[model samples]
Target chain A: MMSARICDKIATAIAWLAAIVILGVLASFLLYMLYKGLPVLSWHFITGMPSDIRAGGGVGPELFNSFYILVLSMLFSFPVALGAGIYLAEYAGTGRVTELIRLSTESLATVPSIVLGLFGMIVFINYLGLGISILSGALTLTLLNIPVLVRVTEESFRAVPSYYREASLALGATKWQTIWRVVLPNALPGLITGITLTAGRAMGETAILIFTAGTTVSRQAGDFDLFAAGETLAVHLWYVMGIGLVPDRMEIANGIGALLIITILIFNLAFTIPGRMLQKRMTGTRQ
Target chain B: MSATIIDHHRLKLMYDRYVRYLLFACAFLMTFIILSIVIFVGQQGLVTFTEVSPGDFFFNAKWDPSEGQFGAMSFIAGSLLATLLAVGFGAPLGLTGAVFMAKIAPPWLREIMRPATDLYVAIPSVVYGFIGLTIMVPFIRNYLHGNTGFGLLATSIILAVMILPTIISISEDAIRAVPGSLEEASLALGATRWQTVRRVLLPAAMPGILTAIVLAMARAVGETMAVQMVIGNTPQLAKSLFMPTSTLTSEIVIEMGNTPFGSAWGNSLFLMALVLLLISLLMIVAIRRLGRGSVV
Candidate 1:
């Protein structure tokens, strides 16, 4: 039988191999997506109207609707998530009610996106008579955003050194004043990082939007009507390849795939990196 | 001026008392939403049994909405097979990668891999589907001698790639959470690094690794766009991995739009979604049990 030393060397080599393979896969995937998609991208492609049967089509409306819906969903989810987070971190007692609330959020996070889509369909679209509109889509997407936001908010609030709270209370400050003046300011950096990461994920969400958003953009470019069908870039990527009738659907799909990767990279470099640095700086000084 | 200042102070005091209730309502809204999802999805899914029996819905392989035969067995089986295959391919790679990250790699390499895994998670499902469609499907058809290259094999490979981040990050945390003193003790005992990991670390970290695998499985089962794009989405039980098949998720994505609301066809699709929901919830419960077992 081989000695343990020999086995140890082999396992170490294998672990190195595993790490290399992962990085290699990721590098190739990103490079290939950019290589296939970059040449097709132009100003017109980003802003031009989609053609139904023609060769030349742009994803202007789809891109517009993506941002529009993202902003709306964030608008709806952020406040509630903030409130919930504050409660859990500050006010919650270790009781059955708190446990139930935690369980609900955890289960909500795990619920399949498609199941949430169906629920959105029944309640937001069918029951509420909203039809397949941006409003309905935004409301459904809120459910997807809530759990992540709540978790982030709670973590951020808890990270504020408890002494900060104690010091404020030691003064004549009320509970509300202590939270608003001390805790919220200190937790801002972590909150921003969480929100940025969540927004990045939300921008790429397709399944929930596909059902409620109805896979069709308004005829008018940059339409702001909440009732208009909102087909975001991710959904457009799927729809174009799967069911679109355009002659150049392959090119459109390639462009969309590449565009999405570029956006994700930008989000990471532009927001997440800075956000992380700010968070580190804040904690370093405070702690 | 004195009266106004007193009124402002009183108003602030009242706001503090009421704000707690507001936050409580916001937190309670989550529970309300979960209950609503179960009630709404379950209510519609239950309608499937009104026309078709439970056994027929669960066990029958033949699924034809127009013919009034609503058999969901094929889709159910396809989901299980695909999830199993994905976990088989993904878990070992992820665990080893975690080992490398947690115990093997230097700090610099670990930093790079951290962002790389996040990037993997941030990539959307539809893009994964697109890659599988344009690259893997064609490559499989040509190289593997598969007829279409769009089936369980292709779907599982894509899913394996998609779930790598989830498995790797969780397993790495589990390994890292193993007390540093355990490593010191093993080394002092003259055990090799691999032996220490194999005998001591693996047993200690087993619960966490299992939790990671189960969560990955949940993700694979619920995955829709990626699988639907590559799986060819036929409603049949495939004889081979290369043959076209549909999972509950893929089938719902394909047919939900075409069926009118409240019809047998539409309700059946909701039932498929309900299956996906219950499976994920079950995985969460299993993870909780694993956590409890580890403490003992």
Candidate 2:
């Protein structure tokens, strides 16, 4: 009974306005954090050690730990996740086991990282006596990363055209060769996007490492021992701010926060820009 | 030539078998990890019930660790209250944005907005916590005039921001999933865009949207560092938005380092984490059910 013309106009305008507000909020969160933190962010801040009483604190070890843990976790998880992907996409045609795997993946995805942190604390640290080491943290993170990589790789592999599989098989190439030479290359973009997303997640992760990785920022410089308890930048920020001891805690938190934001931005841009380009070429679709 | 063909076939068979074995091993590992976590957390947490009464742990409002009490009701109340407030405020904004993104935005706007949402997700939760701690908590304290700026209100706002990208993306997908012909049918009958969305698309996407809301709630409840920073980690019932409170996650994180490795406090933290794990899995199952229902 209402006049559709006026109704459409008003609704369209409202939706557009709402879109603008959401966009503004998203943009401002990024811009404000960057603006506030960038002034104090520097190479020294990136590579220096904390003073006893906050005169000149640096996140050198935390930064090193973050990258070190990320690399360690990735190295361990990559094979497992990639192999899971291969199975799910190439071999998991239809069965209860495949369904079970999918369920496990979904369930694992939603398991709170904090809980995973606790699991690492109890199992790896307490029982196995890994003793708050980076290896324990890495193993905990591998549990987080494996499900993500499996799903992404599976999805990417499934996205490849069935005809390509047929063509490769028709040419007498075995299934392994076809998967390696043809399907794997085609699925590279999704795999890359997944890896980047996982990397961002692992770098930004704090709750999982809260107990599993010790919060101590190593004072002894250039020590890259995996067995030692080390804090990543995210955990470092939380610990620094939580302690509330130093006069320059705010400055340290701000610098590290900006760096965290920048790494995330880079990871995101890496995923999207390449993802978009590869997707376009694969689909032969114009933007 | 015959010998070479036989040799190639044998090699191919071995390679195929080896690759499949590796892949299957990887697949099995996924299930193994999930089972291991359940077992480990169960072993750590389930033993504590003998010492701490379930009624005391679950129902008592006070959560003083020094007093030898491990009541988590206050934390539960805080998490639920914060999630309720966050969903209340965040859902409308996210759905509206999703409506615009899916149904109204021009291609250029969609391009810009999509990346913005992605960027929103990529921002670390700790950064959100830092910004909230420095800006939001203080603003509330100064303007609202609280002794401690950190409280449930600030925590809710930070949570709302943290969950926005999830809600928007999920709701957008749900909205876009609506069959175009259905929209056209409504439009041809002279219903406005709003009416089509309200009476047709929204109804159709309700299950998906519900899943999105629940997902956001799950994410909000599990959030640790951000809420811990702003909410002051006070173990009290959430009497008001301005009051400080604790959550299962924040409580564990705070005590994880200080507590002895296998003390009663450590076991209690494990129990708290068990509660979190169960809640998340339940939400995921509910989401799957809703997803399945919509298809039918």
Candidate 3:
């Protein structure tokens, strides 16, 4: 009996140790990124333009392109994903069409980002003749983001209470009216969280953008044309490290990494905060 | 007045049917998009595959894109090697962590740990790539060579770290689903916690663990930027983990622009994507099997 107790104690200790070590590794990576990346971060770095080899450069263009691609992709994907999610959760029967939708969505989620990149190249760059433009990149990201948004939106809508829907109907509201006024409002937090997470993913994506968004760093500050070739923050960091860009250019890459991390951190916070608040509210009401 | 009321009811019925059709059309559009892409990739890629011998494409030592000698053997080997190494390291660690959270940890600790795991999920892939490029790659280089920057070892470690959350989250869910009564019975029989977990809980949760591992494998294979930044981007097969290598995803990214519409290089990109699609399909099938097996 004593031996069994000792063994139990040993296993418990080891389990705790393992969990702490894994968490430590994650924390250390975040700390190290901030440590190495913060020294180069500044307002000048944020807003400045690319400069000579010796002097430091800014990531203004890359920043602009990242936001532009993110906004464009979100604008394209959000409504379509939401519409599909509503169809699956609210309207569709469990038949051949619904089964096909489920299977495709699952497959789409598992399909590699690189495959999406290849598809974008074939269709947008070749067939459509967009030629590595920002518009093409946005379209590629739209495809990539849709599956995730659809799944999340469907789940959130499904979570709404059946009683609420019945009550809205009893009040003489139309089906569409109940969905918009009662169901959507109740599910708004989850929907926002999903969109923010998807947008963050689209912003930081590199490989698909690498193909659809060409590699050239536009030195011309005033040129904001969507059709012109451009770089994003992630790609710039890659080029800097891989090709030994000028000293200032390297600094610019570091600054961009820091900024990207910050943006991701914010999105993560947005994802968790609403869920946490909802949990707390439920507990408080129960008390 | 009676005729007008009947007409209003008929219009309402027509509108309801129209809405249902619109919803079905939206669903159909998604399926069509996915099917068309897969068919297009297979058609273009098969043409290129015919030009090269299957053995050469799968087992060749070099990939010379410039010379029009396209062989994906090295990239395939590198991707598999890195994924295996990552799974070897990550699976045990993640399973143990999940066990701790699901069975051993106090409620407070579990709450804190759960959010932390979710945070790991939210961290973007590019940030992971950046971290790998800046910190992990240099650390590997310094210890392994003191001069060279990045290689397969670095890529594997980064992938392992990036995949930990997926493994832990899924495995924890699986472990939690195991019946508590079994553990209680084991304890009453004077079995050690270690024995109970190893014998009762883990075996019962094996299918879940397998599902988690399969998902992790899918993610590891599909990973691009983090591995790309740290894998040195070489196209040849190497025996050493410290040596440089390329992956299909990175190759597609690198060669996309230069390859013209009808060129073999472009077709090869499609072929690489076809390979990825096949792997993911295999993963889905495996997960489905595991899910069914668990229920039985």
All models: lDDT?
0.90, 0.84, 0.78
| Residues A141-259, model 3: lDDT tens digits | 88888888888788779877799899999986667767878998877767876787777767778877878886665667636677877678877776676664586655666677678
Best by DockQ: 2
Runs in model 2 with CA error above 4 Å?
A1-3, B145-147, B292-296
lDDT tens string, model 2, A24-53?
887787888888789988889888886647
Model 1 misplaced regions, further than 4 Å: A285-287, B1-13, B292-296
Candidate 3 structure quality by residue, lDDT tens digits, B120-214: 76566767877877777788787767346677788888888878988998899888889889989988997888899999999999999998898
Q: Candidate 3 lDDT (Cα, whole model)?
A: 0.78
Q: What residue pairs clash in candidate 3, if any at all? A: none
Per-residue lDDT of candidate 2, residues B39-69 (tens digit)? 8897788777877898988999877778889
CA lDDT of A59 in candidate 2?
Answer: 83
Q: Between candidates 1 and 3, which one is better according to TM-score?
A: 1
What is the DockQ for all candidates, taken in turn? 0.60, 0.62, 0.50
Candidate 1 per-residue C-alpha lDDT over A1-287 given as tens digits, one digit per residue, 9 for 90 to 100: 36889999999999999999999988888898899999999999999999888988999998899889999999999999999999999999999899888878878888878889999999999999998999999999999999889999998999999999999999967798999999999899889878887887888898888899988889999999999999999999999898989989989998998989998887765787777788888788521
